[model samples]
Target: MTLSPLTSPLLEGVTHGFFTRAGGASTGIYEGLNCGTGSSDQREVVAMNRARVADIMGVEALAGVHQVHSATAIVVEDVAARPRADALVTDRPGVALTILTADCQPVLFADRAAGVIGAAHAGWKGALDGVLEATLDAMEGLGADRGRVRAVIGPSISQRAYEVGQEFLDRFLDAESDNGRFFANGVDGKYQFDLTGFGLARLRAAGVAEAEWTGHCTYTDAERFYSYRRATHRGEADYGRLIAAIRL
Candidate 1:
């Protein structure tokens, strides 16, 4: 099957994609385009999957970070060593910046007029710690205007599936009491947190030109995306990762 990547009109004129798990050479639990080299899937298979993605993006290779779930954002000149960071920014054409995630927000950033692009892997911890803002700052450092940068968050777990504890709620509340609005009461002591909502809020708070989530729930769409929480619930050994990329 050919790869069908989701695109946002907000990022028009930019070569970017929110790729799903629809086409690849993997099997069993890692079926479809599992591009994560860190996954337990065969190394060669993962390489092949990544090559397919790079080919579709019209790049020789994909550049990415180690994604430590921090707010660190690095500028990429070439696909050299993978640093321990969560976001990557680049102004160089033909260099596709990629991020891998399983339920976490796969955010793509671009300031087409400035020729700068970025990709970030934002989990709850990373989001709360300002990964999105860090991405914009990095892009700005590359001469991209934050006011002209458009950010699009790809498929991620929705509030309906994101049950959280009081501690999780407290973390956001401690950040700002207004964060309480992102949570909805759930059964028992659980609260359903709106991660995408929080992400967009952060982006807007940081003054991005525009921001939007694709609104596809990773946990709810097993056929189209991968979800770490879903795999954990099913008692699976591991899960595949979905890839999102953007290029100038």
Candidate 2:
């Protein structure tokens, strides 16, 4: 089956895709195009699925690392046998940089004039750990002017459906008092936190020229997206992760 990739014309003339689970050789709970190496899905199927993505992006190989949800960034001049980081920035053409996520944010960045681009896996942990800023820093390190960098966040859990406990709110407040604005009170003392908004704020704080979210909610949209929280609520054994890639 042909892969389904969501794109943004705003980042036009560049090679990038936010892939969905509509095509591939997977079955069971991990239906289609489950590219996550961390998943319990068959490794051979995962590899095949990934190879398809590489072919579509016109790259020999896609460079995706072991995402530990850290703020760390690695600069890739060429595709490596094994990459060991969360975020990747490169000026290397034809080397597709990929990031994996289920409900977390998958952010793609490009500074076209400098021919530099980046892909990051920014979950709550990574965002608070400064992954967004770290991505911008890595891109600038590769001669990309931060002011020329354009970032777009792919599908993630949205605020309306992301209810959290007071403990979660306490953690953010502990990090920064101003973080309170990202949360709105829910039932009782529960709060609804905006993951995409928080990610956007991080990008803006890092001096990104323009930043935007695709505004799709992974948890709420069952047909088009995968969601860890939703899967857990449904009592599923495991959930498939989606992939987003960008190349220069």
Candidate 3:
């Protein structure tokens, strides 16, 4: 099956995509294009799905990480065993950096002139801990100029669907009181946090030449997205993961 992936003009020159859960070998909760090796969907099926992604990206393999929601970013010289990090940056030709996400942000970065690209899995915890900035730092280390980088955030849980308690608000406020701008009051004392907006702000703050969000809300689009929050709310056994990738 042909896969349908979203792209941003900001990354026009880079070979990258924010792939939706569309065409693949999984069923049930992991209905389409479930590329997550960590998921319980049959291991062979996961491998085949990833291989399909690699083929689409025109790369022999896609490089990725274990993604533990930390701020760690690693530079890849070659595709080997997956590292224990949340982001990856590389200038190597023919290697595609990929990241998996459900409701979290999948951010892709590129510096065309430098032949450097990066992919990050930025959940709220990782974003708060500076994973986005760490990704930029790693890209710069690989010879990508921060001022020439373009970063695009893929589908994520939008503000209207991201309800959080006072504690969540407090965490953001504690980080920076200005973070309050990214939240809107929900019912009672709950607040809605804008994951994509927060990610864009961080990317721009880090001196990226251009940054954009694809404006897709994973939680609200069940047919095209695999949303962790949606599955948990519906009491499903497991959820699929969406992949975003970039090649230098």
Candidate 4:
């Protein structure tokens, strides 16, 4: 099967992709394009899948981090052992920065004129902890201007599917009461959190020139995407991971 990677006009001229789970070697619960080495999927199969993604991106290797879901963003100068971080920024020409997500945001960042690019795995913890802003700050250190940076968040769980409790709502509200706007009432004491909306607001607040979500809900779309939540709801053992990448 051929790889089908989604692109954004805001990142024109940058070679980047929000890859779907369309074409890969894994089988069973980890059905298409499972690129996460951390997954319980066969390691060699996961490697082959990542290689396929690198081929489609036209890079020798796709760089990734251990993804601890923190705010740390590291600058990638070469492909050594993957680091323990949630995001990566690179000014190097052929290295592709990649991030894996099942339902969390896989955000790609680029400033074409400055030749800087980044990829971040932003779950709510990472986002609220400032992973998005940290990515831009790291890119700026590599000569990218925040005012010229363009960011696009790839497939993630949407507000309607992201039901949370009052404790979850309190976490964001404690940071800033204005965050209350990002939540809507859910059944019982639960609330629906707008993760994509929160991501965009953070990007805009950080002074990114352009930012937008792909508007695809991973939890709701089982065909083209993988959803950890959906997998758990179905009582599955494990779930596949989707990759998003960007290269200068």
Candidate 5:
């Protein structure tokens, strides 16, 4: 199968993509390009899928981290392990930085003037924990001005479909009352939190000049994307992850 990479016109001229879960070698539940090594997908299929992504990104090697949903970010310097971090920033050219997402947001960043690029996996927990802000800070540490950075969020579960319990709302509101703006009344007493909107808010609050989401919903779209919520809703064994990448 071939690859499908969703891109943005605002980020034109920069090497970046929001890849879909289409055209891969895996079978069954992981039927597409499941690039997540942390997933239960077969190792061989995952390797091939990542290699394909590396080739498409025009990088001999793609660098990624173990994504612990923390506020931590790493300055890429040929690290040996995929460190326990949620974000990565690099000024070095040819290093394709990638992030895996299954309903969570895979965000890419670029400061064209500074020749710096960043990749992050931002779930609700990570966003609440300030992972996006951490990423921007790490990029600025490498000479990137936050105001000059452009951040784009890839496919993630949209608010209308992201039904959460009362506890989730409590966490966000307790952390910051302003975060209550990101939620809407769900079917019952539940609330639907806007993950992408929260992500954009974090980026903008961190002083990023431009931040946008591709306006894609992973849970609602089955043919082109993978969703952890969808898998659980259907009682499926496992779910694959989608990969988004960018390189300088």
Candidate 6:
């Protein structure tokens, strides 16, 4: 199968993509392009999938982090180092930074004029801790202007499918009282949290030039995406990860 990656018009002229699980060499639960080296999928098959992505991105190798769900964003100078972080940024022309996620926000950032690109895996924990802002800070260190940075959040769990407890709602409310706006009433004392909306709010507040979500829900769309929550609901042993990448 040919790789079908979703592109953002806001990131036009940049070599970047939000790759779906449509094409690759995995089977069983990971039937499509499961690029996660950390997954239970066969290492060689995952490598083949990643190679396909790298080929399409016009790079020899893809650079990514270990994704520990932290706010730390590091500057990538080595493709082999899988540091324990959640975001990566680079000014090097050929380096393509990538991030893996199931339902969490996979955000790609680019400041075309400065030739800097960034990729972040922003789960709820990382986002609340400031991964998006940290990415912009890392880009700025590479001479990229935050005002010129354009961020596009790829497919993630939508509010309609993200039900949470009062404690989850309280976490965001505790961060800022205004965060209540991102939640809506759900069944039996639950709240539907808007992950992408919160991500866009954080990016916009961080002063990025433009920020938008692809608006694809991972939980609802089984044919095109992999969702952690959905897998757990079905009692599946593991889930495939979706990859999103950007290059300078």
Q: Per-residue lDDT for 1-248 in model 1, tens only?
A: 99989999999999999999988888889999999989999999999999999999998889999988899999986596699999999989889999999999999999988999999999999999999999999999999999999999999999999999999999999999999999999999999999999999999989999999999999999999999999999999999999999988
Summarize candidate 6's per-residue lDDT along 135-164 as a digit string, tens digits: 999999999999999999999999999999
- Candidates 3 and 5: which is better by TM-score? 3
Candidate 4 clash total? 0
As for TM-score, the candidate ahead, 4 or 5, is 4
For all predicted structures, in order, the TM-scores are 0.99, 0.96, 0.98, 0.98, 0.97, 0.99
Give the range where candidate 2 is weakest over 10 consecutive residues by summed lDDT: 77-86
| Model 3 misplacement above 4 A | none
Computed on alpha carbons, the lDDT of every model, listed in order, comes to 0.94, 0.89, 0.92, 0.93, 0.90, 0.95
Q: Can you write out model 4's per-residue Cα lDDT over 12-52, one digit (the tens) per residue?
A: 89998999988899999998999988789999999999999
User: Which parts of model 1 have CA positions greater than 4 angstroms off?
Assistant: none
Off by over 4 Å in 5: none
Q: Which 10-residue window in model 5 sums to the lowest lDDT?
A: 75-84
lDDT score of residue 229 within candidate 2: 96
Superposed by TM-score, candidate 3 places the C-alpha of residue 95 at a distance from the truth, in angstroms, of 0.3
Model 4 / residue 152 / CA error / Å: 0.3
How many clashes does each candidate structure show, in the order listed? 0, 0, 0, 0, 0, 0
lDDT of 2 at 217: 93
State how far residue 80 of model 6 sits from its true place (Å).
Answer: 0.7
Ranking by lDDT: 6, 1, 4, 3, 5, 2
lDDT of 2: 0.89
Model 2 RMSD in Å is 1.2
What lDDT does model 6 reach?
0.95
RMSD after CA superposition, every candidate: 0.7, 1.2, 0.9, 0.8, 1.0, 0.6
